[model samples]
Target chain A: MKKQYWTEYESKVADDHYYYERSCIRQSFFTGSEEVFINIVRDLLGKDIADDMNLHTCSGIGYYSGVVPLDTTMTVVARLFALMTEAGYKNFVPSCITSFGLVNEVVDMWHHFPEKLEQIRGYLKEANGKEFDVPENIAHPCDIIYKYRKELKEKMKYSLTNVHTGKPLKVVEHIGCHYAKIFPRQVKGGAEFPQVLVGMIQEWGGEVVDYPERRHCCGFGFSQYMVLANRGYSAANSKKKLESMQPFKPDFILANCPGCTMFMDRWQYTIAETEGITYGENGMGIPVLTYEELAAILLGYNPWDVGLQTHQVQVEPLLDKMGIKYDPKDKYVGKSGAFLGEPEKPTHLKVKAYE
Target chain B: MAELLDMISADIRYIDGLKACMNCGVCTAICPAAEFYNYDPRDVCNTLMSKDEVAIAELLKTDKIWHCGQCLSCKTRCPRGNVPGLLISLLREVSIRMGYFTESEEGRRQYAIKKTLGEHIVDSGYCVHVMHVKPHLHPEQGPVWEWYFKNSEEVADRQGGNYNKEGSGALRKISEESLKDLRKIFEVTGGKDFFEQIDRQSKKKASELKKNITDNVDDNEYFYHVYREKNETQE
Candidate 1:
């Protein structure tokens, strides 16, 4: 079974000269993730990642939530490809896992139904007065990071080992379900155990914690989170994963997808607030970080500069564990050195160094 | 009534997602939504396979189809390569098109998404823009998020975000030309029509329920009804 799925799951990642597509959720919520990703890929690793200011959202959220039709999604994606084509790049790299999956789904549709692709082309020409060729390569940023894991490790100022215990941090790798489950072949490792994140963690000197519900969705179900009443379903699914990973006592939850990273971090606060349950030691919720933010910390970037302060579950605990130093006073300090007020302290979730 | 199976069959997602279901229940076993809710991906697939239009129509109107999180986890585990999640997507599209979605509590919430995410796409070229993330609406974002949004510009600037600026970077203002092109794409691809249908149907439902809905979809009265109203019994 493994061999069959593995054989079916081959994909080629472009080494350089890529068109970087931004993620709506990551930009809106985790504002620093995309910056950290671009810095790591472009500045640190010395890769050419060309971005277009004209690129728009893939509408994956709206499409999956059933408000935007699939045809609309296809046309929107076609416009994105058109922009990439205009920029003279064929390697498409979306910052969001949802966009990656949706783009792959649209391209797969085009492959199976040429008429639909033609319709999209007509729509593109009529609407935007442009044309597009499907990208030659579609790789997620994590895939690129995985491709350069060894080089990144070579340049790392810190490792995933605990400063206190002198042990490898037990990291829970949460693969966004859409990242691989939608099309196993598109992912680095097959759907069951996606190695994109695990590979990064292992190479960066962290032990991967194998939990039972590791394969479960972080429950960002586009509709589930969008609708206020349906949020219970979203919170419940995250609670399930946290509960499963609680026994292992992971140092942090590492996710590649923006939605997964956000939900896994925020839902910990929700669970702590409602149920008074904390997943980490000393009544603290387990911190969640995107692979980029994790990589940024290892590459010696300041914690707050990577937008770690925006995270619901405070990343200070994880930073402390990994021996990454950050000024506690700088958590709310802005670029001009002004103190931008702090959040109202949570009643249940522990913050400020386990006290 | 439109043939439910035909509507589903027309979608490429359905053609690819549904191959055959021997009722193995692997999809159900691995389904997180099933574990949490009354949803069963196996049953959803079986219903479609049965080709019973009435049963299928009934499934469309119920809250079951709306329960899927769109994670596509079922696609990986099915021995016959069935993708129950994609089946849910097609079912949802059919339900909305046929006006069956408004019949259920969960389905009515699509109105909120239509007003927010759907409209955000046509208007701002983003489904969830930073400016639209009201702290009051998203309390789960927690207090820190409240702080960030309170000082969003400064915080964004510190993090190297353009923050609604004219140039490329995180949260840069999507260009008007790009937005015009996006709106055109939506207009040409039936997205505009889809949003209008959602508004029309939701307003009708609001009137049927005597909620005094106004012309503006973003008004608090009707918006809150669809966005926040919770039905414990059905859901």
Candidate 2:
């Protein structure tokens, strides 16, 4: 039998299971409001969670789009740490859609072909001395989050309604590329825009604004080539999505990933300037947020605690537009809502350091 | 002045994509070219807004922008959805419009490659996945994957890939036609002859580089030259 099938059986038998994997964007989540959300999940649900950064790169979508080498990606994922998630009896869960998708690809590939898997195993053993046994039910944070938004909402202390004086947020979602591409059926609780971000936003009192390019991947693929000064294939793709999304005039453009937020927010000003166009009122740019960043606001966490200001593009204009006035200058108060406080360095550091 | 604004607006209209930007900064943080260089997608946005063409020209001069490994990571990870990889191509338009496409050996090489890609797609209705190789006469890097995939056209025909040819081929053709239709959009050779030149001579020029490396250097050295050395030249 394939390794994934057995893992599926094991996953069904066990109730409380979770795993963490590699990411460059994980830095955003570990910092502020996202950290709070993770803790809430653990305390409120009593599920197991593992976070690690020393893991191999997820091959990223760069490979899929025909840029990075295939074998290098395999070596990075298969040889380095896809196997690490198999331990301690918890299902591996990646917060990044790319990482999660890579997990599924690797597990499915190595399970069926013993010889090819051995070659991959040998690559791992030779390159990093790591052998992966494939985890039981490797999945995404969205997979679980989408399934459990109702439970999450019930346990919340604050309300997303009345977030602004009365205006519901004109929020649109930035679904990660891998999650939408690889696990579309799972997150597609039947909507043009997936239900997870919409459900969380609308229930939390933000109005879901469906744009034409709602299911688009922000120009992160060409992000690495950004030195090309807006003259690369990726930039062209970025413009494609931007033009498609231009009609909606979303107050807040929310994303599930750090990379997405940075690309949409940080690059807009350049797109505005070089192109000599006005992006927002008074030439203001669109405000991009992570799901958890919005979660913190809706949950009544302070703005800074959610790292709203840390964003390259300002969120204040959109806040004002939505009739929500978060003092962007609010300093972190070290409040521990459910999971963690502003640690001396952050306790999660110890986990990766220990590994 | 209207013409100037039109040209200027058109040049930076790629920024309309920035308006499309969700401001996720995935392009900034994940950008390899941005990481190593003194570049930031955010800074690029700010600079673009400043509209100081002097600063813009200075920024464009850096080959750092060209160091893009052509990895579509930025496009894939983009959340509010934009394609920075395509932006890099637009940036390349700056050089093309400057009339430097055939200047340096490297520049000529790039022109040839693009010309080949443009030609082959028009001819076969699929992307060029392989390069033509001729042993002893052609250079080592000369053939590319073309020898293996040379038969893919037939395989495409056999496997129903040719059916979608209308979708992609016509799309590229329409794009090329619309670009040409833009009375002002210049430098991209829109004529069919341009692509044919690329297709005819790609193997010849490829052999020139292939022999330059294969006869003189080891495989590892050649690999390093391609994957590393080229990127290190920050010009």
Candidate 3:
């Protein structure tokens, strides 16, 4: 039976031009995912987008993690808006989910207190000698894709069905906390049950598996994970999600936020190593893919070409299930199409002979 | 004294996070951090409600305020419309401003983040740059990352990123003029003062702890002490 879904807000479409602001964690942890997003938007969808070098980090991590103050964080975000305004772009599309939330929150804050907005404008003019008009539309890349899921599906070279099994792949979606929790009304499908990811899964021909703890955090709690002692909190929370989802036997986990994606992917390995236990079938952890990576695969892009090799959890099992052809030998190859020396076999995976 | 109340009232987050606390413990029930540690957002709100200066000061100096993940889950679940997450933000701000951050082990580690992410934004215009993420520092990135780091320029170019290039694309170099404006924004927005406050408090704590204080956060003994210190506790 198809689970019921409803979205409180309508998704925004970028149409053509987007002022792309990159995420800090996404660039460092999953550089390839960002690459895949730009390629799909430019090469596949043929949309005009500008990734401005002048835009600064949203400073969300520094503020939320308790190091940078709120005022500074807001000011930094205002400066980014100024950069976008200067570039003559109004459609704000942030690469990071946290930045998307921060922008929304700052805009809301400014609305409630126009004085604060005036204060930020004063500071920006004094500092950079410029002013900015607030963006007419601010959307996450996932939201943009969600708005155009039907178009993407029409252009898709592959579906989410397993090529050999002739059945839909069972997929689970994890939404980041900041994506909807702060302002539930702004998100598609509200916070209790978000359909932003589900819309993509459905359009791509995948069965969305319902599981307990679906709304729980991926536990990238900046300080919670950064502090070694507090990592148990992260592990414990992830363990809850893993155990709850293990019963459904999901083929893969899909995430929108880069931080959540990295944490869910990497922490599965950590939990397996530390606890001497593992989730998923045959004790091999379920692969976690960012929404963009999933989009790239569904579009028939090579898994290794999209940089799946860098994942802590191997994605070969999923590729094998989908009957996707990729050269394992090229997984670690450099951009120059040269071998980067063989990577030492990952400790978690059992040895297998090459065909 | 009324000064504590005055401090809380000065910030809008405090005003928003604290309402009449009904003490329902719903925030605690929904808190992810509370499950792992002895953290309770309800308790934080309760204590702040006491309006006691000594208690407020003590709360600022302890590791409690740092425990919140700032996921704002409490904001979502709180029936009374109170947001403990925002209260925690206000507490953290006050703590750093007053040098109370050095009083706790978790609080002291603010230096590490300040040096890495806080400084990275001003220096590079990006919080987490490709070259700055050392493999040794983030071993979870695994062996593939080491290779990528060595061949980053080539890989980035092939992947459509204009990394370190002087043009518009992913990870492109920010012009010197823009960088100057960024630094000026910090100065005008009080971000520079906030960073200086963290440095001054860290230096003072280093002297008190008899650790060598240096001009650079990377070289300072106090910085290393906080960054390298490990908590032996495990769940």
Candidate 1 per-residue lDDT, tens place, B69-131, comes to 888888888999889988888888888888888899889899888877888887888888778
B-chain TM-scores per prediction:
0.96, 0.47, 0.93
> How does model 2 score by TM-score?
0.52
Residue pairs with colliding backbones in model 3 are A7-A189
lDDT of 2 by residue, B1-235 (tens): 2332233346332543344565568877766556444555655554445667766555455543444544334654567555564455444444334333333332333432332223333332222222222222112111211221333233222211221222221011223332222211111223243333433443344455573323221342322233222333433
Report the candidate with higher lDDT, 2 versus 3.
Answer: 3
Candidate 2 lDDT, A54-117, residue by residue in tens: 3323534433322222333454556334445445544666656656656655554456445656
TM-score of each: 0.97, 0.52, 0.94
What proportion of true contacts does candidate 3 retain? 0.54
Q: Give the Å shift of residue B63 in candidate 3.
A: 0.7
Question: How would the candidate models be sorted by TM-score, starting from the highest?
Answer: 1, 3, 2
DockQ of each: 0.83, 0.02, 0.58
- What are the per-residue Cα lDDT tens digits for candidate 1 across A244-333? 999998989899899998898888888889889888888888889988889989999988888999988878778877878899999898
| Model 2 global lDDT (CA atoms, 0 to 1) | 0.46
Model 1 earns a TM-score of 0.97
Whole-model lDDT values for every prediction: 0.87, 0.46, 0.80
Q: Chain A vs. true chain A, TM-score per candidate?
A: 0.97, 0.75, 0.94
lDDT of 1 at B221: 79
Using TM-score as the measure, the top candidate is 1
